[model samples]
Target: MVARDAQDNVSPRSSTTTVTTGAACGNPVCGVRQVTTDTDIPWGLVTLPDGSVLYNRRDAHDIIQLNPTTGVKTNLGTVPNVQSTDGEGGLLGLAISASFSSDRWLYIMHTSPSDNRVVRIRLENGRLNTASEQVLVSGIRRNKYHDGGRLRFGPDGKLYASTGDAQNGAYAQDRSALEGKVLRLNPDGTVPSDNPFGNYVWSYGHRNPQGLTFDSQGRLWEQEFGNSIMDETNLITRGGNYGWPACEGTSGTCGTAGFIAPVRTYPTAEGSCSGITIVRDALYVACARGARMYRAAISGSSLTNVQTYFSGTYGRLRTVEPAPDGGLWLTTTNQGDKDSTPNNSNERVLHVTLGN
Candidate 1:
């Protein structure tokens, strides 16, 4: 993509580096290109099938397309009826229909005046072209924090939604509540007949799950935020309960009835993972306070190898999407929070090339 960093240069033969707390990474010649830099909070980065890039600016209420070849941006239009809460509302996640050619339909998870929900819209001619918007689902509790709003269609052609506990501890164990659970439904928002609970609910007991992606094998995986110290990347299974509120990480026993444990976890509190993407043979995870990108090699639904890159070049990196150059795209997020560093301007999109 566009930034000034040296990312376009990653080759299949590029060398790998292992990093830890207070460590440095990337080769002296590894190309990590900073396409552009600004102070706007970027919420998502999505690469269209044709290699074009679309992203959202959480604070600006704007969604724009970036020329993957160049760094230039094309403003699509403001997300209407958005409710950008003090720190964590507005637009969060985005996904395009599998039938993009005929449907040209786009889906977004955002907090509106009412609640956080997934809504669909027609993208005729690639503009917010019309006012045609349909609510796939609604009535999710919205708050200043803990609103899980990531939406992705799984390999089964069902809409998979990640919902946060809305900062309420009780919701995690309340199977009747939609919060703190992963819901699977048809494109129309109704519960699938085969769902374990026979409702939209698929899994429960979570705090605020941010990233969800199914591997090429159709196995579901997720990256979640911890209360403070721990962050997790989990392998999601049917009807599995990921303990939250009751148990933060692997620190304590799940007790009785059983709960699914994370496949891997990062003990470094600052390494708060915001998004996860599975491309080819690796799982790429983006960090917020950690300000770095991590790669985990998976083998048969397990993390086999792990590494980190870009130690601290960017501040609070948030989103990572497939890049046009067979690499990946990342965006910084330090500028969004009022509590961030003074005069923070590290916000921008960075393109990175991963080894084959």
Candidate 2:
């Protein structure tokens, strides 16, 4: 770049410097619009092959199907026996079975009377067959807070889930404890023989990891909530240990051998990122306390060129998923955030589109 004066005298050319722009210049989220409103703390979001979306309310315990094309919503019956912790735990993540076309199974993670569990319910016709519910994974401890609940099936067709420490930080460091770990299991909830510990545990030492997604390369990425210092986004590995109670984000005992570090870290207040999804080789994370969306370019096993969008525009962003049409679906958790006194009935689902 060079500068020219009014007299048409051009200055010498400057050194080459590149400037990046949002979405169009390889950043994500070019434009976004409110697609549906009046939601109740919308939690998990998953898109079906039919272009319809299924999401559950964290506090209401009901699943709702949304026709993105029409903005029409259908109340798909609620899961029975779901109990809210009066804090963060309730009906959380949702994942569609790979054989949904034939099996019609929808998986959910929710807080129950005794613990947090993963169950599969049959979606017969247009409503859920509550009687057909089958509890697959159970015995995960729960608490008023820190009940990490996010479910996603990997490319290998194995079910993967994130569990919180149940406010007991020590549990994160114990491989034998189911709490605060990423668990892998067969679709039938059986222990996969190939699992690291010959049990359901896949990766251990996580605090409150709520974000899980597989990149195009089949590498798993997770986002975790920190105690007071840092929130992390990590590239998950099989049998990897993410230091939680022993470390926050590469601080405490993170430098020790065998402990993996996060690809990116944000101050707790600015992050608390919950849900994540990858679209067009870029990773998008919806943050709660920060009330923003973060977009990071995925560079082989790492994240780079990070950018923030809609900071404070939404009360508290909760979930983000790839839309069937190559866009993104985002949900807000404003109804329950005490910081904003958000209108209980004004929570929203947003449609976000990306550019080249």
Candidate 3:
């Protein structure tokens, strides 16, 4: 599976053969070994056109380039300073420029020195032009947790971001609050005129939505963290409200707020949702408490047949990114909490291109 040149220092090379169920003697999903590591507690991953993998390390607040093929690492440097925070602080999510073919920008969603902001930087030869970094959007609430800070470009070229409720459960329902909502912004970081709220929000009523992405058909979806029980997976739309502190699951109408219910949800003790990815026709979500991979098939507007796997082996699945070879790149989060030595056997990056 040859990939397009990774414009600039980015390229997605077809480094290995597809991992089928019975092909390799010992390994299947993860064919290549991890070459270099950031060791700052890696979070999300994005593969460049040249097969180079870009990842973010939280405690250090740095973005660095990793080459699974050669085991070489080049630091992209610390993200812009973030204010003091706990549980959900420092640097978080990342998004490669969809217009990288021309713009050459790499965007990051992090809690900045002032507030939570999405900033853009240039990656030259696998290094960030940190000095030129600038905030794309600002004034987002920062807190101990629920600072929903995930960013991704929709297939429509609009930037979709998820922000946590900053532990303030009610903010998830406040249309005026930027926290606890999924926002749609133009590439320049302005509220999209066609945005559902006619302002900065695209969808509201979310607790701590960490994962946001689009399926092949260009429909956007998100995975939300439930307070005690009932985590969720939702298909996003204009003006949609995903009941958070207001409603727990797909049970009620979310108090006539016209809530858009999740396609699937489960008890948090069994399934605390984290990262989410749509591969092929299936949606894959990472679980913290469940410590497994939740798989479901997308049927038009919703998801069904939800199942969980990968329990116990990997402590917790953090993020899943679309790969160039039709596979998905998975990241671990036991270290994401910023404590304990990384369990190498479980804390490695994996590429899974599935087949029978």
Best by TM-score: 2
RMSD vs true structure, all candidates: 7.7, 11.2, 4.7
lDDT of 3 at 265: 81
Q: What lDDT would each prediction earn against the true structure?
A: 0.76, 0.87, 0.75
Full ranking by lDDT: 2, 1, 3
What TM-score would each prediction reach against the true structure?
Answer: 0.87, 0.90, 0.87
For model 2, state the Cα shift of residue 22 in Å.
19
The best candidate in terms of lDDT: 2
Per-residue accuracy of model 1 over 1-356 as CA lDDT, tens digit each: 22332223344544666656643344322467877765577776677766778877676766788776777788788777778667577778888767766677778888888888887777777687548888877888887787776777888999888888888978877887888888788876788899998777888888888888888899888888888768888888888888887677776555635788888888645578878888886888888878788888889868876888877877687787767566778888876453322224457888886654
Off by over 4 Å in 3: 1-38, 251-257, 336-346
